[model samples]
Target: MAATLPIIDLQELQQSSSSSGKLREACEHWGCFRLINHGVPVSLMSEMKKVVGELFDLPIPVKRRNVDVLSGSGYIALSSMNPLYEAFGLYDIGSTAAVHEFCDQLGASPHHRETILKYAEATHGVAMTVAAKMAESSGVLASDGAGLFEDWACQFRINKYHFRPETVGSAGVQIHTDSGFLTVLQEDETVGGLEVMDPSDSGYIPVDPVPGTFLMNLGDLATVWSNGKLRNVKHRVECKEAAVRISIATFMLGPPRYTVVEPPAAFVDGGRPRLYRPISYEEFRVMRQITDKQAGEALELLQGPAQPLSTKFDVNSLPADVLAQIQDID
Candidate 1:
């Protein structure tokens, strides 16, 4: 049976002990949830959304000026896959320099940059807190610094779904799970079309909007980081009516090449084997691009013990060609 999108309170998660169980359950089962009082200021969210709508309303030529440091990290326009959808992306939102570059590329004014930077800073704080709580919920101790992703590569994307009268009942964006560890999204409050897959893959359940809140979803990297324990939720957007829907998404992706991704020892044990081999985010990112399964397939292919953690072992053990290909992902 399908379930409503779980609701979590960020303040409660931090102040109460019971929140740990709730957080862990939502991650393990639903893989997605709605969060309230997550500490991203309501005023900032409003300003950010206004800026996003304005950003997408700009001339195509100006929008196209945005470039990608990593693949698909730039302005994406209407395509065959989803002609009604367009988006602008910014990579490594945590870094001051990256945010500045994104603003400059879009030719944003000083006010726009201020709003964007402030919103990014607030969202990142919420993301890190939620991520750490998830780990603690699963038995990871605070002393180990389990929930830190402050330096992780985060990508912020503003999505605009152009829903015209003729496009009602159409797929604005295809059904897919994010490739990152998790995504924090500010969904359109008055527009309701985002649907998450039912547990059995039998149908879809709409995630209606709640004001002053954001939604979070565990993704492929989260599943790998949790050793297959966490669910990688798949979702899509449909056009419910003729209305312009705008949303902002902050994706907290896996660690960079310098910090190889591996399931914590707590998630791996004799009874439950390691479901994935440790690989850099770059390697995983390239795999997803080549395979074209934005959700799960590439991560699955990197599974098994054949390729162990590159660290604490000799890299020469793997075939030279294979190693070279993985290195090229960076």
Candidate 2:
């Protein structure tokens, strides 16, 4: 049997300021909610859909040729075991011009690029609004002054799921939390397979897809930013025999390398001055990569007290040497 995911009407949010309380409750308890009747144009969405479909339909060899996991800026194709099911991803490179040129070279409509930029801008604003409300609900900052995340960055990712129907039972993705602060996902309405673990029920609950709506969830950075006041729920995607699932997600993240992530003073109880040392985002990302490569050893390091700041990789502000290293990775 399929379970229903909660849907929160955007109209309600626009109608009353009190709606934030409800939004906060839903986010806290469910860790996921759908926003309906949002302002994104339907025509724009259609164009995006068309472009994405066209891109995916390209020859597998052409697709593979473009895959660059190290670029962290382009396309990625992998068969890995994450919390979600198996998937292929195309990450935006923060350059509208570059994406437009790439699409144009592939004979994609130029209008699609324009529409994507517009959508990204609008969605970024919406994410900021929601984040502010969440901050208020978590008591980290005032509803109007939840500016701790003003320097956040936004990333757009398009993911497609491929399931081999003959394969008896396969999981799409393993259970895991997103790496950033928050994620707003727009999933294909026809197919269903996304599921979130219900902390209260200890069972998986399905999230139904709705047209013109986005599924919003908290991520690891939010938990860290709020000092664990807000939770980043674990969720996974299962492969369905009936249809393939595709989703467009935008991740809103914290500031660049130099920014420090520390708990708010309000979250500190029992006189625990500051639980985390001030670590730059650059340092954290490198440490994260190392941790991913060596999970067992990373766990051991976590068990010990804070060691001095040893290694930090500023990918965003790479020096000439670092740029060369990245080119090698790319």
Candidate 2 lDDT, tens digit per residue, 103-125?
Answer: 54445456656666676667776
lDDT of 1 at 134: 87
For each candidate, C-alpha RMSD in Å?
5.3, 5.4
User: TM-score for every candidate vs. truth?
Assistant: 0.88, 0.77
Task: Tell me, by lDDT, which candidate is best.
Answer: 1
Shift of residue 261 alpha carbon in model 2, Å: 1.3
Clashing pairs in 2: 82-174, 83-173, 83-174, 83-175, 84-172, 84-173, 84-174, 85-172, 85-173, 86-172
Q: After superposition, which runs of candidate 1 have C-alpha atoms over 4 Å from their true positions?
A: 79-82, 305-330
Tell me the spans in candidate 2 whose CA falls farther than 4 Å from its real position.
1-4, 60-71, 78-107, 140-147, 269-275, 285-289, 293-304, 308-311, 314-330
Where's the lowest-lDDT run of ten residues in candidate 1? 321-330
Residues 1-330 of candidate 1 have per-residue lDDT tens digits of 446878999898899898888889899988999999888888889889889988888999999988764554677777665478788887778888889999999999999999998998888888888888888898766665544576787878888888999999888767777777888989887987888987755478988888789999888888888889998888888889999888888888878653677777778889999878877766566566546666467766876556633434433344543332221100
